[model samples]
Target chain A: MAVYTHLGAEDLASLIATYDVGELVSAKGIAEGVSNSNWLIETTGADGAGARFILTMYERRIELDDLPFFLGLLDHLSAHGAPVPRTIHCRDGDAYQLIDGKAVALIEFLPGVSVDQPTPAQARAVGAALAEMHRAAHDFPMERANTLDIGESLRVLQHCGGNALATVDPALPEMIDHAARLSAAWPQGLPQAVCHTDLFPDNVLMRGSSVTGMIDFYFACTDAMAYDIAVTHAAWSFDKSGGRFDRAIGRALLAGYESVRPLDPVERQSLPVLAQGACLRFVASRAEDWLETPVDALVTRKDPMDYVRRLHFYAEAGDNPFHPAAD
Target chain B: MAVYTHLGAEDLASLIATYDVGELVSAKGIAEGVSNSNWLIETTGADGAGARFILTMYERRIELDDLPFFLGLLDHLSAHGAPVPRTIHCRDGDAYQLIDGKAVALIEFLPGVSVDQPTPAQARAVGAALAEMHRAAHDFPMERANTLDIGESLRVLQHCGGNALATVDPALPEMIDHAARLSAAWPQGLPQAVCHTDLFPDNVLMRGSSVTGMIDFYFACTDAMAYDIAVTHAAWSFDKSGGRFDRAIGRALLAGYESVRPLDPVERQSLPVLAQGACLRFVASRAEDWLETPVDALVTRKDPMDYVRRLHFYAEAGDNPFHPAAD
Candidate 1:
């Protein structure tokens, strides 16, 4: 709902006509995904057989140039025996196409429902999967991507005026001001790699306690590997109250990742700050988005303080403390 | 620039003509904003010679329907003596206009350089200003805004697929799963009020360690005031290495906020979890945005994890421990 794809059943039908894979039985929007338009496509062949695949209309909201790198990485991972969706070729023998001005592709559906919650064992499996993917992706052809230089996030905060500032209890502005200054002095120059920038639990698919597949490759790029690890730690370790970090969970994830592609000393050393950076980026962006969202789009409210506190924790810890729980 | 407003200069000219107040001496783009095209217009002649105003091309990236609320709020705050940009009427005596499919408006500008950082005393001033604004806006009429609903954020997390999940360490899926389950039993039904959805440090302007004004009203809407306090705390307080919490700063901020507007027991009770929820929202969104940004924009990188850890901290504490730093 964040984007309007200008796609409809008719457009889908017309597009599918050229792909002689099979007679289309039905296609409907799947109730998953926040960034792209995804439809579960069911098809019956002339031979009276059937198969299911996910028809995804790549979000134009994302930069189109990055598509090849993302898909290529997925292909590379899949070729290397990573658990990922296999790109189904289109009628033109291409794995991807531009349909209705969006990067459209068909991916063979992986079996298994998304687990709402996972046990520690399942968490360990996820660690293993990620470690394996990072290890396999080391030879990804594209170079690493850098942080966006444009201060778009800073600008967003600037857009909300006095009223927004008023809501914050008294001393916050100074603390923020201090952090902003200190942020200028934050460490730089870290080792880079093919980073899965948006890894979180929901992105992984499971069947009973085993991670069956990993999906969504859009944010994949070359960046600091430690950043990727920090992202994972942040996403995996926090509890529901968003209050405490679960040491066991953090250990499992890191252990899983390290088992495949061992972290260098520098990567390990910078993990905490990398985590802090992740927190700042989100807090800044969410605050801006919260300010920018239209008054009535059925858009949900976002709390800006959660990440603020999280950043504080990472600042205090100063390093990754948990060993891999999976091992 | 994310958006291009075709007629920025022309729109400013139109406003000048309508207001019949002054002659424009200079207009230049202010590069500090992310969502809208802004220009500083120096004016001379009628109402006040040697005066300045800001011409803004409303960003179309925002939900168009919400412009009125934002602009109207600005006007209201200005009327109540809050240091804000006063809207200048159009030739037809309207506060806003459409030019080249963009919302265009002009407002009286405050003249001062934006201080990048402010001292703790200034932070207190910011807190006091916020209190004044909240007090002024307590009865100002506006519809409901973002409520920081946890359900929607959880839904988005669920859609993040393996590509996104893999980027995170495996342990996160379990942690998220646990959080989702625990969230069902979390407290609800708290008092709500108008909140500034964003209040980061950069949004406030200071002159010689004195907070002169608060700017940006795009995210201002009706929500819990504590959420605003949490947002401020998140923005202001930080630990050393810029990842941990500074208790003194937190105290200063909270003291400033509570001085003007006393928080009832209920609001105080909700602060910790509200802070956690805020962290989750930022982490989830940053993860999603990381996935969506174009790989080539050089504008993309992993979000910081500080906020995630802070969430854990708050969860562990299970209460707000903020107190004013003793002068």
Candidate 2:
């Protein structure tokens, strides 16, 4: 609620007229997303006579610098025949426009409902789609985004040690400190690739039992490809209790990913530790955020132990046993 | 940063003369906390001769109704000679004041530095202090707070099922549903007592290896004592990788607590599920908050899986193994 983008009816109608494929029919705000202002635009045109698209006003509250990359990435993927949304170019031949101080983009709206919990088949399809996207964009040029590096992650975990140990549990600091040291000692020198930094289940769309498309590339950036795989594994492998990783699902996902683009031995070797690093990063942030929560916002209590346990899981496992398909 | 509370040097001197304290030699803001503005007031007066106190402007963001209960609880504990800051009675012997649209209070500041991590002895001391505080407040009268009972918790988990199952692991929703069902079936007849809702490590202060004081009682309210223990256990027992619970630390904490105040049989029986419930509550809140993070905060990504594993741990454990020392 800190920032918002609003589009008036007249502006939306005028904007819709510029698109060659559709006649301006109706536009209404979609209430789904919390981030950007989305309008479901209905168009009647000679091509299909009737088609639906989403007109989005980029929320200034989120990083605006990454907008071009996300939109361009989708455009590139669509051009390569990937089952992704096609960015609707404006009359000026631009994929996006600056309107009313917000970045505005129109994309062909794919028909599907977001599934809360996807079955193994759905997860597998997502894994496959992600692999394909990674392969297709392997050479795509983009600057690195997130500021965090391995050293920064290590520093966060190290900082938590003092706070963790000083409480009712005296042993947590040493354990976190040890994990930080171990993760720091992990071997480096892997090739970096474009990664969908935020690949939570909600970001992927499912049609029937299969993933039809992937969305939300706002966090996508140039990073270690294995780290993305690690993120995918972490996202997909945990059971509801979140206590243990599901080996079957892990295998299914890895198999699906390898079917499209296989991971090298070094990438495979670094995964478990990368996952641990991911866990540590989240824990440290949550811990710090917990301390900073306004006394009035007492409803928000950061659960530091979640990442703590996840870090432990990666440490104990040493390496992920599931292998990507041997292309 | 939004509100300023300090008076000018001349104004502060004039204000000091009206109070019982002889003279305020020095006063400065404590910049550590993100909430309430705090000033370390050094005063020389006939009553205490030379004493230092912390004057705090209670943040309006916190529930104003609950402020009296927290102030009373602190006053009651200090009066009982507990190792807590003593609230200083104002000119009219009141413990609080309305200053510049905010609640303000002054308390004799306990001498100690906030330690990052405490040794085993420090943890034990905190455990003992918490137990003693609980025992002392057993008969203190207060209205019940946080009406979202056990049933509400079950409802949230059930509602989150679709979202939980649709991600990487389909089993997570099943586990949450199972825990919810099991928790629903369990008997609930535990006695209620005053509980410190937020007892994380940083909230406790230490002088060397000894815990000198506990602060931040904004969430203190009447709740099940076993729930408080569960909160403590969850806070204290996690190992470094954050994947496993440190049974040794758990045992030590329980032993330390029981040395001062013992848990009833029924209370002991309910601890595990309560701990699971605590885990569930945090996970649910975090998951909801994850959807709300400003797209721009690019500062951190909140991982929901961390809590899933914790809930699984308590569910697998089945029952709390904690026992108090023989008095």
Q: Which stretches of candidate 1 lie over 4 Å from their true place?
A: A1-327, B1-3, B6-11, B112-117, B168-175, B178-189, B239-242, B300-304, B323-327
| lDDT scores of the candidates, listed in order | 0.64, 0.65
Return model 1's CA RMSD, one decimal.
29.5
Which segments of model 2 are wrong by more than 4 Å?
A: A1-3, A21-28, A31-35, A45-48, A61-63, A152-183, A284-304, A320-327, B1-327
Each model's Cα RMSD: 29.5, 29.2
Give the C-alpha lDDT of model 2: 0.65
Over B20-133, each residue of candidate 2 has an lDDT whose tens digit, in order, gives 776665454443343676666667764766666677787755667777787888887767666767677778877777766787777777644343334456557777878877
Q: What is the lDDT of residue B274 in candidate 1?
A: 72
Q: Per-residue alpha-carbon lDDT of model 1 for B205-323, expressed as tens digits?
A: 55444555677777787877787787777767765223677666677677777788877888787787677776666656666676676555324345535556666676776674553
TM-score of 2: 0.45
